[model samples]
Target: MKSMMMLMLLLFLMPVQAGTPISEYENLLITEVVVTPTDAEMIEIHNKGGVTLDLTDVYLTDATFSNGNVYYYQVVSGAGGGGDFNDFFARFPNGASIAPGAYQTISINGSDNFFSTYGVNPTYELFEDGAGADTVDDMVEATPGSIDDDPGGTVAGVSALSGGEVAVLFYWDGNSDLVQDIDYVVWGDKREAVDKTGISIDGPDADAITSVYLDDTVIASQAVINASSHAGGNSWQRGNLNEGNETGSNGNGVNGDDETSEDLNNTFFEGLPTPNAAAGAPPAPNLIINEVDAVSSGGEFVEIYGSANTSADNLSLVFYDGDTDQVYQVIDLTGSSTDSNGFLLVGNTGLSPDVTIADDSLQDGADAVALYNIDASAFIVGDPVTVNDIMDALVYDSGQADDAGLLTLINPGQSQIDEGSNGNAANESMARCPNASGGSLNTSTYQAVDPTPGVLNSLCPLGDYYATADDTNATTLRNTLHEIIDDHIVFPYSAGTTDTWDVLSFADEDPNDSNLVWMIYKNNSYTWKGGGQQAYNREHTWPQSYGFSSGSLGDDNAARTDAHHLMLSDVTYNGNRGNLYFDDCNAGCTELTTDVNNGVGGGSGTYPGNSNWFDGDSFEVWNFRKGDIARAMFYMDLRYAGDVSGEVDLQLTDNPGDIQTGQPFMGLLSVLIDWHNGDPVDSIEQIRNERVYSYQGNRNPFIDHPEWVECIFVQGGACTTVGDDLIFASDFD
Candidate 1:
C-alpha cells in the first residue's frame, strides 16, 4: 500500500542526530503562534531562564506518536493529505541555541515570506534550505514521501493549523529511549479527542490498523491546557508575558506548558501579532482626563493630568457622540506634553491648548472624552468605542439619555456623570475635586466649578457632607448643621505642642506677607510675636465674658478657645472693645481708622466709613469684615448647646440687655444680621474658613453656603423656599 511506502520515506529523510538531553530544556516556552495567512505562519519560543539553552534534539511537531507510529494530518499547498511527512514537523539542528531573555522564531512558511510580512528575518526557516543570509539557524526537515497516500484523518503542518490543533515541544534522549514533553498547547475543540483516544498502526503488518481507546488500566493520560482559537486574526499568547515569567503549567511540571486558562476570561485581551518580541499590551500612560467644559459656546475643552513635564507622545484624546455611539474626533498629541504643573489641554482656539481642534468639536452632552495610549492615525472617526489601550475616560450627559456604549468604558457600578447635576453656570466646567484623587475610569470625584485650566482644580463645596442635613425646615437645618459640625478635633488654647496660636498663625496670616498676621480689629498686618505681651492678642468676636470666660468652665472649655470666633487683633483694640455688643454707632462714637490693602477696610474720619466704631456699650466692625464677624457669632450660637458637661448654650438675641456677663447669650442680633448681609464673604474669609477647617475638622456653613443664613435666622423654622425673596425680606426686617 502507498501508506507503507510513505512511512519508509519518512524514516529515510530524518537525519539521525544523537538525542542528547540538556538540563535547560525546561526553560523553553512556546510563547506565540500564528496559523492564518499561511505565508506569515510562525511559532515564537522564549528562553525564560538566566543561562543560554542548547536546542539540539528539540523537536517541534503537530504529530502525535502512539505505539511506535506517527499519526499526522498532511497538507500540500492549500489542500489536506499527501504531502512530504517532513513538511509537517521540524527539529533544531546542531549549534542551534537561544540566549537568556531572547526569542527564537521559526518561520513555517520559509524566510522570504516571514521577512516580507513582518519586515524582519526569522531565527530559523523550516520549509527551505538555510544557505541564505537571512536565516539565523538552519532547521532540519523530514524526507519527502515517494508516494502520495491518505492516512485516515490526521492534521499536521503549522500552515494547516486552523483550530482543533496541538503543538508540542519535546526533548528525546536516544541512549535510554527517554522522551520528555517540554510544552504542550491545545486549541479549539480537539482537546477532548486528544486526551481520550488515538489511532494504532501495527509495525510491519501494514493491514493491522485499529483505533485505541483509553481505559482506566491502560490510559496514557496527558494534561490538557486549552487556548483560544484563531478566529479574528489573533494568536494565542502566554498571558502576563510582559509582567514576569509565567508559572502556570499544563497540569505538568514542564516549562513550555506553563500557561493555563484558569483566569482566561479576566486576563485574556486581543492585540496584534508580535513576532519575536514581548507579548500582551504595553504599559498604560500615567494620565487622566481631569476637567471638561462642554457647553454650547465654542470654548469647550478637556484637561489632562499626569506627572510633571512628561511627554504625551503617541497619546490621543478621542471624543464620542451619543447618538451614534461612535467616535467623532481624535486629537493627536504626538508633540504635546504636560506643563510644569502636570496639566495639558485640548480645546478650541484662544484657550492656549497643547493640542487644538476645531470649534464645537466636542458634543455638549450624552458623550465621552477618552484618553488612550495609542497613535491618532490608528483611530477611525466612526468606529465604536473600545477599551483597548484606554488610559482614562469620562462619560457625561447634560439632559439626554445615558449612552450605554460610552458608559461601558468607565469603571463598573459607576454611572454616567451629568454635567448639569450640580447646577453649573454656562461658563463653568466639571473638574476632578482634590486634583487626581479618584482611581482610573471613575467620575464620582468630579464636580462643577469655575474652569481652572492648566492649574489645580478648586476644592468642590462640601454638598455631600450635608447630605443627611434637613434643609426644608429652619430649626431642623440648624440642628442638623450642629450635629454635622459637632465633636470636631479640639486643639488646646496654649500648650507645649500644636495649639490655637499655631492654627491662627496660618489661619489669620496676611495673604501678601507670610511673616505677618492680619490683625482683625485694626484691619492691618503685624509681625506674629507669639502669645504674652505681644503686639497682637486673640480677640473673642463672641466675647468669652458672656458665656465661657477663661477658667469659669475649666481648661477644657472648647467654646472659650474656639478658633472660629477667636481672631488676631491689635493689643490696644482688644481692651477697647471688651464685652461690648455689636451695633452701628451714630455721630458721637470714636472712629478707629483702617489701612488700605488686604482687599478690604481703607477709610477714615466719617461715621463708619470702612472703620471700626465704639461707644463704650457697643462695637461696630468696619465695612468689609461685618459678615466675617457675624458668621463667627453664628458659629458660637450653634456649636455649644450646654448638653455636654462644662459647655455653655450660647444664644443670639436682638436685645442688648440679655447679653450679661456669666450668661450664655450675645446681642444685638438684628444689627449682626444687617452686618452679615451688608458685607458678603470675600476671598480672605473663604481662605480663613478653609484654613480653620484644616485643623478643627469643621466648616463655617455661612462661608460655604451664604443662602442658608436667612433660612435659619429670619424664616423662623419655615425654610421651604430659597433665592432673592428670602434675602429681600430679611433685609427689610
Candidate 2:
C-alpha cells in the first residue's frame, strides 16, 4: 500500500522531458552530509543542470548557527586547509567548471575513509586540523591542490552531530563582491533565522534576507535530508531509479525536482549511506523464493530465482515451522554465487535426483519458509528471529490465513521479499505471474502451479483450478469456469477401495470413528464404511446406472470416480438406489435411500424403502444432504461437459435412456436447484470441497460457488432458460 502511494507521487512529479531550465542553485543540489566529532564535516553535491557550470565564485557559507556568526568557505578542487576553503573545499584554478550530471564532495580530511568506500573522489579535502578547535567563530579556505594552516579565530566551527537544525547553502557571487547572491539551496531548518518552524527556502521574500535562493518550484521540491532521522546506513536517494525514484528531468537529480518538495519523503536517502556516491544508489534484490513443493508426493523442494542477474552467494534460505515456532532448518548456500535463476534448494537428493539441487528442509502442508541474509544455525525452536534477518518469508498453504494468523509480506527491507497468501493451494506452487516484476503477493501476483522446482516459474502448468470463488455471478467467469481445473492426475474407483481411503482421511479425517475416515454416508456424522461382516461401499452420489460409465478402472470415468462426489453409503442402500432420478418419490413405487425405512441398518429385511422418496424410477435425497448431493451431481455433469461433436453430451435432465450405451442425464432439475439454494454449503460440504480440490486437482464449481447453479441451469431466470443467450447477464439485464 505504501509503495502504491509512492508510485502515484513519482508519476505526479516526473517531468515530461529533461528540457527544464535549471537555476544555478538547483544545479548543485545537496544529497548527503555528515557533521559529527567536530572533525568530520562533509556534504555531497549533484550537478543537475543541462551543461557544466563554472564554480569560480561559488561559496559554501553558513547562515549563522546557535552562535550567530556568519562564515563562508570557497568550493574548489583538490586537498586544502587554508587559503580560501582548505578547511571546507578548494577552488579549481581559474576557468574551472563542474560537468553536467556529476557529483562533488565537500568534506574535512577525517572523512576520507568514508568517501573511499564508494570510490567517489572529493572536490576538495579539508586540511588537517591537528588536535582540537576552541572557537565560536572562524573560517578557512584553500587554493587548488594545497592544504594551508587553519586561520585561528574567536568563533568555533560547525555544531556537533547532535540533532539540531542546520542548512547548507550554495550561492554564487557574480563579481568579486560576496553580497549579490545568484542562487542558493537553504537545506535544513536554520535555527538562527526568525522563523524556525517551516522551511525558509520557500518563504515569501525578495532580494533581502537569504531570498536569492532558486525558483519557487525548486524551493517547494528540495529534498531536505532530515538530520534527526538519519541513520548510519541510510542515504537519501531514489529507491528504484528505473521505476522513477528521482526528481526533475535531469539524470543527476536523485531526490528532488520542481515537481515535489524536499518533504519528509524526499529529505534523506532510502538505504545505507554511500557518502560521495550518487544518492539512492544500489538497487534492491529482485530474487524471489520462487516456488515450493511442500505437498509434493515426490518429496519436498524449494526453488529460488532472480528476475534480475543477481549473485546467489552468501544468502541463506531458512525454514521456520509454525508447529515448532523456530528456525527448523537452514540451507547455507556457498560459492561466488548469485546468478541463481534456476537454483533448486532441495533436501534429500533422492527426491528430485535428476534436477539440480543445493540443499534442504522438508515442507509439508501449512508451513512457513523464510529466506535470510546469513546462516541461522544458532536459531532454534522457540527463539524468535530478528525480523531484519529474514529477507523473504513465504507460507505454502490453502488456508485463508497463516497458522499464526498473520498476514504475509511481499517485499524486503524498506524492501523486496515476498510471502504468498490466499487462493494458493496444494499440489501446486506459488509463483509470480509475470516472473519477478511484482510488488504484492495477493491472488493476482502469485499463481498456483504443478511443482516446477529448478525451472523458470512460468514454465510450470497453468492454474486450471487453484483459485475458486464463492459468490460469483459474472457470465465471463462462468464461461471460463472449466479453465480453473487441471486433469494431470485422477484417482479411479473400486468396489470398496480406491484413493478415496487415503484422500478421504485428509478430506474428512476423523480419528474417533474407526481411523481418520469420514465414512458411512449420512450428514456431518462419521460411523464406518464397515469391514468383514458387512460394509458400505463408495456410493456415487450421481449413480452410474443413470448414464455414467461404471469405472473401466482407467481414466475418463469422471462421473463414476471423481472423489468430489463419491461417498460412503450403506452397501444395501447402494443396490437400492440403482439408476433412479431425484424427485418426490410419493406415488406408489419402490422407495430407496434417505431414511431408516429406506432399508439401511445392521439387521435389515428385504423391506423396500418406504420413507426415502423413491418412485421405482426416481430417488429422493435427505434434506440435510440435498445441497451436498446437488453439488456432486452438478460437478459430474459439468466436469465432463466436453464438447460432444459440437454440443454438451452430458447434462442433468429427467430422461437419460437406459444405463449404459445411452447419453448421460439426471432429472428433477428444479428440485435440485431448490435443494442447492435451500441448504447452501455447510461445514461438511466446505471440508469436502477443500479435500477434493487437494486430491483431484479440481473442485466442484457449484460447491465453491452455489450461485453457479442458477447462472448455469436456469432458462431465462432460473439460469437455464434453455438457451446459451439466457445464461448470461446481457440476456436479461
Could you give candidate 2's per-residue lDDT for residues 525-549 as a string of tens digits?
A: 3444432233555666665654555
Weakest lDDT window of 10 consecutive positions for candidate 2: 73-82
* TM-score for candidate 1, residues paired by index: 0.39
Q: What is the TM-score of each candidate against the true structure?
A: 0.39, 0.36
Which candidate ranks first by TM-score, i.e. highest?
A: 1
- Alpha carbon deviation, residue 249, candidate 2 (Å): 82
Name the regions of candidate 2 deviating beyond 4 angstroms. 1-478, 486-488, 494-498, 508-516, 519-534, 546-556, 589-611, 644-648, 656-661, 718-733
Q: After aligning candidate 2 to the native by TM-score, how far in Å is the CA of 484 from where it should be? A: 2.3
Alpha-carbon error at 86 in model 2, in Å?
Answer: 98
Tens-digit per-residue lDDT, 56-146, candidate 1: 7676765443322343221111122123442355568776888899988987767887888889989987655234455356566422331
Question: Model 2, residue 153: what's the lDDT?
Answer: 31
